[model samples]
Target: MVKTLSRANYPDLPFYPERMIQFGEGNFMRAFVEWQLQQMNKQGLFKGSTVLIKPRNQGMGPRLDQQDYLYTVLINGIMQQQLVNDREIITSVSRLINPYTQYDDFLRLAENDELEFITSNTTEAGIAYDPDDRLDNGPQKSFPGKLTALLYRRFELGKKGFTIIPCELIDRNGEKLKEIVCCFAHEWNLGESFLKWLDEDNIFCCSLVDRIVPGYPHDKATELEQELGYEDKYMVMAEPFLLWVIEGPEWLKERLPLAKAGLNVRVTQDMTPYRERKVHLLNGPHTAMVPLGLLAGLETVEEVMTDPSFSRFVNLLIENELIPMLDLASEELRSYASAVQERFNNPSIRHELTSIFLNSISKFKTRLLPVMQRYHQEKGQWPELMTLSFAALLLSYRGDRLQRQDSPEVLAIFDEAWSDQGTVAQSILSNSNLWGEDLTQLPGLVESLEANLRQLEVVGSRAALEHRIGVM
Candidate 1:
């Protein structure tokens, strides 16, 4: 008989007070943050549960609660060149509170005395300023607005503010989150006392989270359930290699004890180096690969990694070109880049190229644009491979070849660029509004992009990619 996963079935299971409130109870949070906390619990370094608050209504809080907040995380990858397939039921999440359905409950949670740390992974799009959201509404639609109301409640209760750590892929996510919340305060005309409390009480820490949680193992469900002897609705799958770099003070280590728990978590004053490594090496490559790879006639990340032409193209771009532009040591950079390649090639996980293509224009601005600029600054020439990727992006928007999920404003710009504009490549490049600066003004960037775009259009991305390598 398959016994249910709950403390009711196995009473020896230990439960703790809710000390942390995490937003966005998605797969990454489930497999990475929540699983890490479970480890911290096992080591007796921390004895605290998490109160989950989803960023939006389209979440699984109610479903998670149905099973007593019990779910399994399957860590899949190659460890020491050996296949590692491990699954553990995570019980760190005490309950999932949907702020939309139970706004009062969500607001009341702010007054919890033990809650000191707040973490969120609302994806790239969740953290934003929605002007229409009013303070008096049942639940402010945006994450930042919802957070501001929660913080206001805490301030009213005289509760010390939380250490807000955002795992959003954006740079300085913590700082950006705080900025949005402050914007909310000003927009809503919340109060002076509230403003002062926010300034003095809260701590916003930036972070970089690198983990490929392919989410539900839908394909291997039957095999997994038969193996585990119980059905888990919220089973998340991820690679074994996980890293969380939190930009925080010396006190954070004392509080979380993740380092003591033997987890790959770093608490430092600045997480910029780690962030850069992830953004430039892992994320930047992904952004470049998606449009080009899709056009190259590849489906999954593993496909691109396995393909000799596409794989070699990315490795050269990262190692030979992009790495020299960074301030980090070559050894560390090489190791990170190598690890990324390994993860990309993981046989167990199939990372769809289209999934990574969401908000691609926004992704390029953050992930690849800076590297392109720095490379131009250092080498005084266009980074040809990176330029090829940019050309792929512009060419993608020129037609319906690649499906884009960028913001409406961004889509509008690209729509116009691809339309009646004769010199569309140079025209789009001149829009500092899009690329953060006039990319056309960069020496040889526009010319190089135009050349590559023309080549790619004529011969397709795969052939162009191979031809570029051959010419090099």
Candidate 2:
């Protein structure tokens, strides 16, 4: 007989009342939010459950339902000079409702007076405006539209307010989402009573979440299956360290108290410091190293760290380019930066550079350009690592033949740039939209970046990085 894994096997797990309505059912939410909720349930800090909503048609809803809303989360990383390995069965998700299929069940959730919180990670693209989206549409096309309809329904049922937390990567995500939702309501002419409820009663929180969840490693299924000793079709692998910072009122701390539950979560009035720390140390280094490191014939982050030249290049980028631009204490920034490097060096996790290289142009503009501008305006000199990193980025965008293949659109952009081929360095540096401003006018940035680009084209990525850093 085939043994089945059931809740009875895990008797210590608690089942609480459902009070949360989550809008996305992807791996990040599963590994992060639901995992945090399970911790809360275990500590008796919050005795509420989550009702998951499939915001889009394509997701893991069917597989999740097949497993009876149960899944395994594996945490792996370094802690106190030891490699920590642990797993838990997350069961806080009480119900999964697909609005596209069961329209009545989806709308009826709005009338539930017990609902106190609404959480979402509907991806950046999900939150958009669709003019055709109406109040009567069974399931609205856009996330903002669907949310507007749900809030209106709750307002009609006597203004039952809930805390709204959005985990999208956009800045001021919560406030922007709320603004868009209200815009939809006004566009639909949902009436003044509903607008009042939206403005006064609800709490829209901006949140910053940090964790690396490489979802469902299908290639290593056999080994994972043997290790787990049971089949888990939707198993998720994530780093051990996690942080969730919510920018909202003090009431949230009293209600949730996630820190009291022994979880790495904080409720604060200002998330700027935390946001800056992550963006500058974590995301900034990742992007800066991708092109330079990958072209050095290194495939993964671990590989880059093992090579002395590339490793030092990354450290210099963080210390010189990114760190000087921030107002945080040097020791605190260094500690966080060290942790980020350790996270990158995890042997178990295989974070691909090609994946991070997607939308390279836009990412560079948003994440790194601001720091470059600040350093130049304040310090009167170009940040060497950042300038060279920009050169590497432009070269990476120019397309490489030996390393790997790129997207056709990416190839096309490079091809167009190559066809003109008139002072390739100057042409690329002059593109204001890419650099967010005319880098040509920035004191030494354009000249330094152009010289580095020439070096990259002549000697290659690794040698160019070493040559620049050696001189410094």
| Structural similarity to truth (TM-score) of each candidate | 0.88, 0.93
**Cα error, candidate 2, residue 450 (Å):** 2.2
For model 2, give the 10-residue run with minimal summed lDDT: 1-10
lDDT of 2 by residue, 1-472 (tens): 2223455454556677888999998899999999998888887788888999889877665767766778889888774346978988888889898889987898888888888999999998876788889989869988888888888888888857889999988888899999899899899998888888998999999999999898877887667777766677888888887889999998898787788888878788989988988987898988888888767777788888878998888888887778778878899888878888888888779888877777777777777888988988988877878888888887776654433355575556566776684766567667665555666777777678778888888998888889867987
Model 2 residue 158 lDDT score: 85
lDDT of each: 0.86, 0.82
Candidate achieving the largest lDDT: 1
Candidate 2 lDDT score at position 24: 94
Number of clashes in every candidate structure? 0, 0
Question: So what's the TM-score on candidate 2?
Answer: 0.93
Model 2: runs farther than 4 Å from truth? 8-12, 400-417
lDDT of 2: 0.82
